[model samples]
Target: MNVLNTDVLVIGSGPSGLAAALEAHRNGANTVIVDSFARAGGQYWMQSKYGLERNDRQMQAGANFITNSENLGIKTITDAEVWGILPKYRVFIQQGSRDSIEITARALVICTGAHDFVMPFTGWTLPGVMTAGAGQRYVKMYGKPPGDKIVLAGSGVFLWAVAATIVKAGGKLEAMVESSSNQFRLFSLIGRHPSRWTETRRLLSPVLRSGVQRLNGYRIDYAQGEDRIEAVKLRQVSNSDRDASQELEMETDCLLVSHGFRPITEITALLRCEHQFDTKKGGWYCKTDPETGATSIDNVYAAGEVTGVTGAQSALIEGALAGLGVSEKLGFTRNGIERKRARLMKRQLRTARFADGLAELFELNTNSMPRIDDNTLVCRCEDVIWGDVLKSWDDGAQNLQAVKYWTRLGMGRCQGRICGVAVSRLLANQFDLDPRIFGFNHPRLPLRPVTVNVVHDALARKSL
Candidate 1:
């Protein structure tokens, strides 16, 4: 086995990872960055090639910030998917071509960001149906169009930005269904986080000009078609409390659905770090001191979406804080930049947490998902269905763990990374309750998919 040593390894090349690496490098600590995607910007730059007319600036900023940081001694590992973290800060990374790497660092910053939350529908498995992130990536990175005529259906800032991207890509948007509880309620919060106003103005600028029709109070009922998505049905959502009413249905060829993102906290949970199940941040977010971004695990710091889904702004600040803390802990701060970086990071932290109303709307609730029948497919990777989960419930499967075993639900190539929340919604549907009342089974670590060979190698070299 080969070994690569660094003073700090910051995972994920998005805004957060970029800031962290920049801070660490500026503080005179050796730092490397990695992400599964090919480029530096995560969502900001790559959401859609036809981003909102105004999004170009931010994406450019993110790209420049990261590339510049990389040029200044930040090692970058593009197209690398990390498998797991060993006990002694060894990060096992698997590149896209299946080549593996073992990265041993004195401190680890988990800037691995969040993914879009998908609650399945009858025809959601169809071709035209995808998460908002996927739809954006189709145009942004791959140079493909979402479709000629499309409907952007979901909540949060990403949905609006994606809608604009579609319009800018020369694709016609038929409708946009928003699940934001009430944008008016948080009007006061916008002041606290000044940066949000800037981001919001930028994201919404293009969509407003695109002339895409806005469907204010409707949720996607299902995508209906045989081979691929040909039409989407929508129900008029009632006031914030209940599901959509069956009066309204939008006739369209494609439906892009995403209600923001939940925390990718499975690996964090596996570490047995203390977590507080805040229904506000979508799912369970890591409970860390806001200042250091340090979790309960010693020398194991989390940044970006793995800690919580606070958008690019929050991720950058948190990553910088973690980077400073890690450098100080590892004695890389002989130049006194740690104190300065920490102060700057803390100031930016408050700027990012500004009145994010998306947090209130997108909670871990089965009620938010489109109606699921007993035969509906819940786990896309393993082909597990609602019937299988319900059958487990019928056989006395009480909690999420029992649900997982009875249906072999979470056992798959990607593990339960994607479908964990969807299955939780299915289980909560079995009993009539909000998913927050009882969330998914506590996330066990080794968050990414790992092979036996990687484990053996990591264990053999754990003493670094």
Candidate 2:
């Protein structure tokens, strides 16, 4: 392994990460960006490794970003997985399975994005049931539909986007379900954020034109089949105050459900950054100064969804601010730096207002856990059922950590990323406390699982 040094190191290749890298380089800082994916664009612009397509606006933008970043003189390492970060900005990365690399940077920008926040329901672990984000990735990135007939059920506006993508891709949609029933929010957003009207229309046009059955305020009660999903049970909630009562069942090959998105904060947590639990902004987020993107840690900054779920446009603006902040901190003072920062900050504020409205529209009802049978698996990794969790609690295993100790709730292949939130919410409800009281799982390195060979190679590379 060889140790590489740079002035700024960005941890993701998404919209924010790319923007940060370009801005930092333009401001006269030696910058390096790394991503686990083979391609630069994150989920929004998931261009396939085989080739590029300009059929869609996002793909075209991604293509342009890739081409522009190539000429910007910023080093970008793709197909590399960063496993660990230590004090003094030391980052350990593994390329493929065997090779290792270490990078040290004066200023760090963490743009690690987010993942679909899937709230567990009865039979949610069925084979054909997947996250709405995962379904979109399968269609957009891999060019494969998750199933022959897809039923989209979730909160957030992203559900419509996925539904449209499927319908546009010549696939069949069994139905589209949104747990949000307040349709006035859409009109309110249009009135407040006129610029977003076009985008909102674009995402919804195909679904409406297809005339697919769209259910609002309906929750997927469960799915039933022997091995994969065959039928789904839905309950209609008339209002937020009322329990879902009107039951409906439909046959479908695939069920896509996502409450929203949770920020990917493994690296931020690994570095011990301060966090705040914001349900509206998707769960626990690494706190950063909105203007500078500076975290509690000196010389370390954060931007994009890792900060919160502010979508791609806001991420672009935040990333630029972080980059400029890094440039200034590293003694690379460019002309009109303050003016540039001010402009970026204004743009961020505007986007945030609109994002807040959207969040209000799709906020999840975390008030209670979805109705589940006694045998429903809560922790998929450990095969821990709801009964097991309750049993552990009755045995004096209080709090999430205690439940984990009793039943290994978060101790699995995912290292608690997937099951942690669901478990926390359940515990919060059981304890009659806010979900944030329990906090998130304490992440340990390596954040992701690594093979023994990779570990040995990383160790052998260092002669200390």
Candidate 3:
């Protein structure tokens, strides 16, 4: 087991973590930033070459700011996955399958960001069905086209970005979908739905700029084809309309879906950090102060989507805030830094407010969330299917935790990091639990996976 020490350890190399690293280094704290991805740009940089990719001039500057190790003392590690966190500030990590390292840090900054939601629908398991993020991944990371004909569906700017990328890549946009049904429905609901309308405008502004045709208030019935998705069948959902007024079918090879993001809290959950189910952020967000990004644990701060599902800008701001707070906590910064910190925090607040509005409108539909079909696999890690959980539910499993236990749904290596949130709701709906009792099945620690040699050597060190 190799051991290294740092004043502060920042996990993730996204916009926020980069900001945190720069702040930590500038304040004279020795810091190391780590990410699982092969590249430093997190999703944005990794996805930059895509047709709809971002320019990210600010993030580019931040990255450049932190690259000077002699100036800022920022050390970045890529392709590293943290497996576990111990109470004594020992982080067990696997750099790869055979190699392992343990690092003890005075403070920890988590900026591990969020995951886009994949609400299950019929034929969602088909090969052509993918998240808009996946489509972006195809474009930017893989430099490949999902298909020549793509239908970008779902609400929010991300889906629109995908549409733009596809069309810009010369892929045909068979259709672009939004849950909001019709123009008349907006007028009818205007008096009673002012907040919704405001959110609509903020979210739709980016979508409209993409020049994608809209299919409002449509629910996809399923995709057609035996092995691959040939086309999608969508039916108009009720908005202000009293009935399902119209049905539309579009020809496309790929159908992209995105319902927004969930805070990726697997490592934090492993640390046993206090959590709150914030539907606004789309998943279990760490309990942290709005000012400092400090969580329940002392000297361990969570920034970016690891704390909650805010976008890149919010992540950048919160990462900087957490980095600043770490400086103050570690006694690294001199006087007068708070003024600069306060200014940045205020800017972050504005973005956070905008994020609040964006988060609400693009959230996964409550009615469309239960994705387990009789044959559809729910826990990919364990190969558990809907029928398995349904059988467990039939046997009087009343809560998500219960279904998990009976089916071992989250007992796999990924430890339900991916499917736990979706399954929690499915159990709640099936068992008729007051939706309120949908308990958290958050991840557990030895946060990083370890091999026998690493564990044996670590236990040997404990003997010393």
For 1-464, candidate 2 gives per-residue lDDT tens digits of 75799999999999999998988999899999999998788877778543434456667788899789988777889888889887888888888777778898888999999988786778898899999988987877666678988899877889888887787767788898888787557888878888888888888888889899888878777888889899998887654643547789899889988888889999999888999989888889999998888999999999999999988889999999998887888888778888988888888888999899889888877432345766888889899898899899899987888889999888998878888887787677656788887788778878887777767766786621
lDDT by residue (tens digit), candidate 1, 160-271:
7787666666677887877655545544566555556867776677788877788665677677888888888776665454553655666666678886687776666665
* Candidate 3 clashing pairs, residues 3+ apart or interchain: 82-448, 83-446, 83-447, 83-448, 84-446, 84-447, 84-448, 180-217
Q: Point to the candidate with the largest lDDT.
A: 2
**lDDT agreement with native, every candidate:** 0.71, 0.84, 0.71
Candidate achieving higher TM-score, 1 or 2: 2
The candidate scoring highest on TM-score is 2
> Tens-digit lDDT track for model 3 on 1-464?
77889999998888888888888887889898888876676764453434233343333554464455425546777777787777657877677666667789999988888877776666777788888888877766655668777787766657655665555455566678876433344434444535445545544554466566777667666677788898887766644542344667788888888777778787777777788877777667888886777889888898888787777778888888898888779989867787977898778766776667665555555433322468777787787888898898789876677888899887787677666777776665665654446656565545545677766766777822
RMSD over all Cα atoms, model 2: 1.9
**Lowest lDDT block of 10, candidate 1:** 46-55
Looking at model 3, residue 30 earns an lDDT score of 87
Cα misplacement distance, residue 14 of candidate 3 (Å): 0.7
Candidate 1, residue 428: how far the Cα is off, in Å: 2.9
